[model samples]
Target: MYQVIPPCMELRDHVSHFWFASWTAQQDRVQPVYYQTASCLAELAFAFRSSELVFASVQGHSPHAARYNAGGFLSIFGVSVFAYSLPLLFDVPPAALSGRFCTPEQLLGREGALLVEQVAGEADLPARVRCLNDFLKLRLRKAAEGDHRIIAAARQVMKPEVKFDLSAFAGECCLSPKQFERRFSACTGFSPKLFDRVSRFEYLLNNHRRFTTLTQAALASGYYDQSHFIRDFKQFAGCSPQRFFALSGY
Candidate 1:
């Protein structure tokens, strides 16, 4: 089973949501699960029965999902960080994390280890979420404020049906195109063009039900043609649009 819960009010600015999942094996065998690439956000995940906590990056260039094995019983609690919000809570730059998974100790030092122990001790999911919230609050107190302009730009990029002209958008933000590209990459781990591409793909995924056909979905999401849409859909999702829709039960 999988579920998503909204972040607490205090965490809304930096965190998107808290997600949980659990699965039990029907037999003594490993099951494979493919986690699709998300090019616009970062994730911090804790496994209740394992030490390998995962901090996954915005996979801007990766063409395949992250694969994992599951057997017996497994459970996970994850914090979904909003785009560009990682630097606000952790010292690591978003660009440094692209297409990689870092351990808690690698990202947070000794404190991360202690947090792992504390979270593992809690058998209840809500209590574990509270612990994570407290940890994030402490980190926020010590961290510098993030630039709001990037967040604003991200919002604009995500709007459906908007024509994304990077040069024009950069000018509106009072930045040269090159300057905008550099700062945007530092903040979101993706160049403005790449971010727009990913955002368009995501829109297609989320709103496929609203369209009568895959071609319509592609065109409505801003792809210029079927081939362009299919290429990007395959690159980001690791499957053709038809297969992805089927797998996702859309």
Candidate 2:
């Protein structure tokens, strides 16, 4: 089963949601699940009853899916962080984390280890989530304030129907193109163009049911042609759109 909890009021600006999942092995072997890359969010996950804590970067540049194996009794608790908020909670640049998964220790050092210990000791999902929320609040206390302009720029890029103009947008943000690209990449793990593409693709995936056809959805999400949409769908979703929707029963 999988569930999501909304972020606390104070964390609403930085966190998208908190999620939990648990599964029991049906067979003697591991069952694998594949996850498509998310463009706007990064995840920090902890494996309950174990010392495993991992940070997964938002899928950028790489088209590959993240794989996880499930066996025995498994429980997972995770935080979905808004892309722009990663640097506020962790020391690593989002660019450095792109297309990779790292141990919490690698990302947070001693503090990450302590967090794992705390969560692992807790058995209830709500308590674990509360513990994680407290940890994030503490991190927020020490971090620098986020740039509202950049955050607004990110929100602009996510609008599915809007045609993104990088140079013009950068000027509006009072940043040179190069400066804007660097700062945006640091926060989102993708250049402005790539981020725009991924965000568009994500919008299509989420709202495809409202459209009658893939081509229609593609066009509405800003893809110029069906081929371009298919290529992007394969890259980020690891499958053709038809196959993905069929398998997902969407």
Candidate 3:
């Protein structure tokens, strides 16, 4: 089974969640599913900070193919970039990125695709992820810091029963409205408003379960009203909050 190291406080800024798993050749199996890749002796990593689709491919075969099944995973989440790798997209209408689903052999930077396994048994997954995350953090720190800053700002801006304004947000980012929109898209692969909306929805879904009332869930998640919440929920999750709650069985 895949096991994930818990997040260190500093690294948690960009990582929504992290987990790792290893299986014998016979045990490492995958179900046909959308947005999920497979592995053997594999490590899976992801980052969901801003809307930007930053992810990595340290080792492993592509989910779309069955060669060099040794196992490792590094993928980004966002709108399809259409590179040789599978371009998983996250946006207004989030969809898995698509591509030839290339393997480690095709990597431009050899270490980039081979490091996941080299460190697997190193006695510290969380520390390793956090250390590596430092690199990603520095990248964000240098590359406008807009990605991390925006997500952090959005979290603060969200409130129950209140709708966030995009124009005001643009002003706060110190960019003209038009410039903000362009920069937001370039960094996150989606507009600021849309990214915030989806993020709120994801937060709600993660917290909801069998006993969580629809009204309570909506309220806590920043829905202005039940109807408003339902509209957004259906659009993002492909089901109403009620249905999702029932299916959750939590």
Top lDDT model: 2
Q: Each candidate: what lDDT?
A: 0.75, 0.76, 0.44
The lDDT ranking, best first, is 2, 1, 3
Residue-wise C-alpha lDDT for candidate 1, range 21-138, written one tens digit per residue: 8766446554746456545767777764443433322222332455555433367787878668778877778777777777777778888788778777766888888988998888
lDDT agreement of model 2 with the native: 0.76
TM-score leader:
1
What root-mean-square deviation over C-alphas does model 3 reach?
Answer: 9.8
Give candidate 2's error at residue 176 in angstroms. Answer: 2.3
Colliding pairs, model 1: none
Evaluate residue 155 in candidate 2 and report its C-alpha lDDT on the 0 to 100 scale: 82
TM accuracy, model 2: 0.84
Instruction: Tell me the TM-score of each prediction against the true structure.
Output: 0.85, 0.84, 0.55
Q: Rank the candidates by TM-score, best first.
A: 1, 2, 3
**Local distance difference test, candidate 3:** 0.44
Candidate 2 contains a number of clashing pairs equal to 0
